[model samples]
Target: MRAFICAAAFILLAVPAWCGNIRLENKKVRFIFESRHGGLVSMEDLGQRRTISSAGGAPVWEITIGGRKVTGNAFSSFTHRQTAPGRLVMTWKGWPEAKNKDITVTVTVRLREQEALSDWHLAVEGTNGDQVPGIVFPQIGGLQHTTGTNLAVPNWMGELLANPGEQLKKPGAKFEWFYPGHLSMQLVALYDQRGGLYAAADDTAAYRKNLGVQLGADKKLVYYMVNYPDQTPGRQGYSMPYNAVVGAFTGDWISAAELYRQWGEKQSWCRQSRLHGNKVAGWLKSTALWVWNRGTSAEVLEPATDLQQRLGLPVNVLWHWWHGCSYDDGFPEYVPPREGREPFMAAVKKAQAQGVRSLVYMNQIQWGNSTASWKTQHAERYSVKNADGQPASHVYNIFTGKALTNMCIVTDFWKNTYAGLSDTVLNTYGVDGVYMDQTCLTRMCYDPSHGHPLGGGNYWVPNSGRLSDQIRARVRNGKEITLSGEGVGEAWMPYVDAFLALQVSRERYAGVHGWQAIPFFQVVYHPYALAYGNYSSLLTPPYDALWPAEHRPANMLQPLDTAFNRQFLLEQARSFAWGMQPMIANYKPLLATERKEEIDYLLQLARVRNNSLKYLLYGTYRRAPRMAVPEERFPMSRLSIYAGQKDKVTAFEQTYPTIYHSAWSAADGTLGIALASVQQRPYAVDMQLKAADYGLGNSGKIYLVHAAGRRELGSYAGGTVKVRFELAPREVCLVEVTPE
Candidate 1:
């Protein structure tokens, strides 16, 4: 994090990190940007009486090209002037005629009431239109690091960092989030009790980007976004096709989410139809729990069947590792199943007959180097190549040393084979759907023969989205064949029926602990996509020791002999409260007789969800009212497969409330609120609801909904309605308010 100006020519501006001479304001917010009429400076929400940004910060904008770097003030010339009443245009040029080859950048800033709009354009006139690591524009700096200030990022599901300066400033803390992969969405919120600031790259074209707000050395927060422009050979210029927004609001993270949704709901991808338009199979709509299993029939079937019988709910098991070759080593060589074709097909039929729907797993991006297709199909010709002509490869399985090359899906072979393989799996195995792993995550490719930009371009996202549509339609065959993936992203929402969301509920992994998750994704797209699976964790004591070093967690914490349901109940309750399908992963460990208590709790949650299908599946997810309860500290441990069968693993001191709650509004113009108690004993819950606050209308009747049935509480014409109740251990409590 360098200061405002790094060059000697701009030494005068370096003393005070950020200086602003122009003032822009609306009734709610006051903004001061551009020191000498240039660079973003400070912001204050007048209604909240809080300043969202400080005075010291880095350069407002910067770019890198062909290994040369420059800032907004380092372009050898700079000028700005008012273009309209609330708009300003800034220009920079006069590059030295060396490797620079004469590049220029223009930025247009406009203040629309409470929000600020920043748009950018870059012109390249030389041989250095490549090697653009990233273009940092609309760089906002000087956010004060305080106790209550929090930052929310839209990761796999969503990640809410509490006191980022204190928690995220340590070494190894990940800061940057790249979209269409780790980041499922393009919005983030910086907020506290007073109010919040919302910022997003509101682009409909779906370009890849790095968005983050890190705690710098001085503890000052710096919010920024890295936009990768088209770095094609002989390209001349690139202009932002959309506006980047920063606005001030008077609410929590959910309020910030609604701002993004205003523009998000209108996008072409969502305009096609929301999730309730039956984009998924009829069975998938009512799916309540997902069981995740890998390996052969011996490892998958028995436990999956047991779980389905115990819960008495629709169970969709995502089965992995059925290919003939070893796990993670084979590409599409899926014939002669490892369990023996006859045995495997029989196993699928058995599970289906027992009401267990099977969704087969296949990696979408990788083509194993050890497979025959690598050479016979000429896949090496279309594989993603680095600048040095090496295959962009990844290695996870330790069985074979051969790597898996990321295939370019834009080719006919990649597209046809993916769809063809899925189609065959459904017809042959009589499975429900094909779960494509890592379909939304993309890599930079440099193979010019693929008709894409060398090393970098924005062609991957939209093309992959279209490929999903192709695969879905091919496998359907007039049936409700669903297309599922490992993760969720906005571009693929309209096409894919469901997505596995393990990253949201996993409290600790890869030796890092202390994760606080929020429902930022569901707040915006809960109804647009069906989310399931939290991986094989919680009561499941088995940890894969063969996992790669960087990914293996320190096991030994999950001791089966002294099994406890503390962590299990908390995580499942979170999944239910957040509107995700409650998942029970790796049913082997969960099948232990001592774990019957945990399994029964899962059954209770399933029953509750079964009764409220309309709200959980078809209703809009609303923000949960703030609940402040006493924290319960629990001790948790896990096993390490890579280290040893029994090495004493350090237990992370897990802290969470015993009660988890969520809210939703149904299409029938009613509100539903659910709360679950994960404590071993009992606890009392007291909360008040305002009709106007939750959009429950001016008059409504309150009713209590339990597993057995619904019971009337009372009626309220206006103002607040007080409801108090006590929940038994692992109890799921529901409240319904119907308009009069």
Candidate 2:
């Protein structure tokens, strides 16, 4: 055994004292470890004058062994060394009071040669697979938040805490979400006006783990991604298959996102993805608007058809509640439409014949608690259960609050049944597509009988993916059809044709400050899959109000004013600028008689998208050009339309950039910078674009393209071009650049 650099610094030694803090450095960052307990002592960016890490008071790593939990500080023995330049090796052993002397953990940190970051890895020795739950590595403490500092997390539509330190101190802030599920991406970063410290699990395989962004003592942030070992019995010692990245960057989340994009684009999920292969259905690729409606032919079919003609754009009707059974209380029984089989089917056909893609809504996970099939068909055998043996259940019915059990997709019986249901919707119902709700949701099932791991493994990702494949090959029968889910989960990007980013509405958790919803999802996956929709206001028929008070349009539509209308336009503009196909939810005939200004703007946006399809629809998302514009905040409220519940909701001010701008690049070296006005009056914008930054040469032709027409803005002869323009009231336009 190698002796410590100093005796007392490491252990009692049973001898004279001699020890010192072990320092390891690379060109990008330097790390110091306290030999006494191997805690992270300090970390400093080579370019900055301050330390980004806190004092050496936190454990270097943590793990669960034989159902017993321990940390690096729990070990009585430790050793460390710089095995090579820009690399350090630390080992911890002699834990559990000699009960598991065979257990040992090794921590390795390396400064990447070409990247300004440190690569981390961990290997555990001597443990049966099931005996070890997971390992938490490279834990960083003392991330104190400051002024203008923000924390970026991959949650719904990508969340940004404008003031993270203050926000985390607020009530009801989530500490962590599992990767590729509750957490959309596998990374977290704390950044500000100065620089950022970024951490991510750079595994293309996308191991299941908790990307812990928890609150530490003294109002600090602790970031550690928990990596699970395969739980199969008798498996060998676990070594991290992918490197954990911790690095320093010079900008905001977008800069770190670029670094992640480098690794994300190469995964099988991205490489073989339909978007990357350009295999997205032509109908979806050309689609610019979605009209989400519920109910029979009168409420849905008529309005959906009219909107297509009115907007003069392809429209999709995502129809919900066409079946005879109660919306949330019926499972595996969708035939005999609400109005009748013939009328509903005919409406679907007529809408399709008129070019309105009809997508029926189905919740794949929920099985009504009182459904007959649950007992007669022995559906309990195919449902998910917790470790305590309770079924996973939810109550979404607004009036009744009835519960539904979640079905396990990994089970063979459920998979066959689900696909068979989809087949009926496609063939018998005659819909063009199926919007599979909850497909992107993750569940931790402990039912070993389902032929998958009990919990905390990669079972959910591939099972959900393979089921989509089976539905296409079996249910869809190789036809080009859209399969969509609720939110964007990175693992599902390659499997489904589209994902609905309803979070764009920013109405869910209103009243919460420091919350900013950005299009970080579209930035990463717009090209990989079509993302659209939000729980914006509905346009239900006045006849909807004629229904029972509890089951009426009044339940969905909120008391409105000009401010809310302005907010709606801003949201739709955001969806468009962020590269998402715009969605109008719950459209009813009553809408035709109201909101004329909003309707006109919607039509104009459709035209703009159609004209710039090469860039806005299918191009790559580059960094959005910054606009030092005035901010606008409109009073807003949430509606429980999607959740099928009617109750008091979050109310707050929705903020917007009065003049919005976004940058995109087409495959042919054309850069499209979109600009829109959220105000009722014209807004002027004068900005500069660096040609070479977007891969454009010094000289290029510039044009201003709008839904109505286009006009050349003359040619630029330098690397930077300054363009000045004023957008009309509620205008949506694109500034295009092409090589001369």
Candidate 3:
């Protein structure tokens, strides 16, 4: 399709407006636009000669080298605000009438300080101060197509078509929400005509650059808690048992304390969920444990065996439907066979005994099923209507003798159904949480035949070939309610504590590099981190499954148990722990036993560090990056205590050969260094103190370095200490030597 061009690149409201409608204040500019014609529209930073874009603005804006001069209208002023240092103009442009005649449009942009934190608010009012709704500002040269009615662009065209909604699976599709900044940080929501919502950007590539500043990519913590709807809807004050609860992800964050406060609120619903809130109260500490299951089937019973056999620990189990079932089954209505439930419950009992909680899956909305037939009898309306004004059909339900339609979330009937079902599941069946699925698909429905419940039209709905306002509205409202695939944009942060899953690319550094750029951009919004792997992680195309010994027809990397996969498994475990992001293993049903073991290890690790694993996993810690202490204040050789003057070190353990970079402070600190061993073979390490490493920066003092038993070796360091065995392969010896 040809690009859609707006008659006016930027048009302002002819009425009175304030701060140019920039929500955060002067630090950032807000572009609230509706695209009728789509093409690139550039916002040039005159001083830096830099630019940002919207729509099809990439040709002229995204490229840093030689590019074509953006054709079409010259930029015009919509509104202007005069600030102390400079004048902010809410600007736009219109197609040139004749070769060089100056275009009449000029935007009046205003900048103001954000009332709250680091954010700056910007607003672009019309020359006459009139407000414009649905204004979208693509960075310089972004593609602009004839504006569709939907608010969000379809997933990026890496592989998917421009209109992914029309396709069942958006292949090679990357969905980025409204990011109108140098550092694309905030994720925008797309509200659909069907009265549903979706957070478009939740992955690494999309989140790093928000509102501009380029932060170095480093994995940060992402903690998420799942809060179910009050089975009674508007009513408050009912409680559910802990066992009836559902799924959640675990991780660390830069601002964990504040996030924990927000988590407390989302979980407020759990109070009415019939849970003894006290059980999870200690969740704040590192010792709190939780479980995430790859598939929800009869085999879930194994969770009990694993939980009891191991630590006999308290855990929470998030049971999900098998892959084919997650999409094809009729959501909550598509119950597994009765035979499956018994074993599922038996596993739940096992988890409960081990202090584990189990949460079941609930559909976000019914898709594929015909609304007429299913709605007529399903009693509980849980399906959404499609663009054709009919409920979509199911590929699986038809094959399984359970053809069903999708449900509509906007309808009172559907809302009531959720309350009834949730209440019954929690109270009657003794469940804890409801793991709602597919929240990422919320968008607008343009079927005029049905009454529109979410008044403002769906922003996710498409118009001609572009996004529409109806879809945008649906995205916004959905933010007001639930969290799903939508990433942590500044706008939707409050509603989402974490993401359901994190999908990433295969290349490690590229993936991690993209993630590191988040902090310098936006901090208010955060989402749990997740990445892709053919193994446990969810794969779009079926991946090579790890077969059990009996199932391995041909030799691959088949492990006797899952022990062979330890390297990658441990790395992943450590990554989640270090970056402060939670790990969700989306493995298939056939490999539940192995996946469960890894899950057990992760939960145990999380429990040890007061729920803070970034230090153990990533090792590149910030908050208090460096420290210095006086030698006199140092503790004994076997001591584990704070070394710095601030006493910031909560706990420590003496180990070996750990690489301490120049980042450590040694001014007046301890006179000794700690090392497990220095020999290639089994041998004790002893040395005299030397100040050479610290140079003149350290006070001239010497001390003796003692040695302990040798340990095993690993690939990274290439040597080991003398020891019969090293339970934690990652743990090394502490080399302690003082000044000479």
lDDT of each: 0.70, 0.75, 0.28
Candidate 1's TM-score: 0.89
Error of 1 at 203 (Å): 0.7
What would the TM-score be for candidate 3 when compared with the true structure? 0.46
Q: What tens-digit string does per-residue lDDT give for candidate 1 at 1-740?
A: 23334333233322232333556666667767655426566787777777888644356677776677777666566665556656656666666643654666777667675453333333334434556656776677777767888788888787777777776677755378887677888887887886666778777877777788776555677777877776566665567666677766667788777777777778876765436566677778777677776667766776777777766777778777767765566777766677777788898888878877778888888888878878898888878887788888888664346678898877767888777887677777667788888976867777778887665556777777667777666664576666787777777776678878765445424333434677777888877878887643543234332334564444432434343356667778888887878776666644456576777777788778878877777678877666666678866544322223334444665677888888898888788888888777777767777877777777778887767778997777766766666777778867888878
**Candidate 2: global Cα-lDDT?**
0.75
lDDT (tens digit, per residue) of candidate 2 on 203-313: 776567887766676567777778877565675568888888887777788877777777787778777777667766778877868887777777778888888888877
Q: Counting only residues 3 or more apart in sequence or on different chains, how many pairs clash (N, Cα, C under 3 Å) in candidate 1?
A: 13
TM-score of every candidate relative to the true structure: 0.89, 0.93, 0.46
Q: What would you estimate as the lDDT of candidate 1? A: 0.70
Candidate number with greatest lDDT: 2
Candidate RMSDs in Å, in order, are 5.4, 3.5, 17.8
Candidate 3: what lDDT? 0.28
Alpha-carbon error at 298 in model 1, in Å?
A: 4.4
Q: In candidate 2, list every pair of residues with a backbone clash.
A: 6-18, 6-19, 7-18
Candidate No. with top TM-score: 2
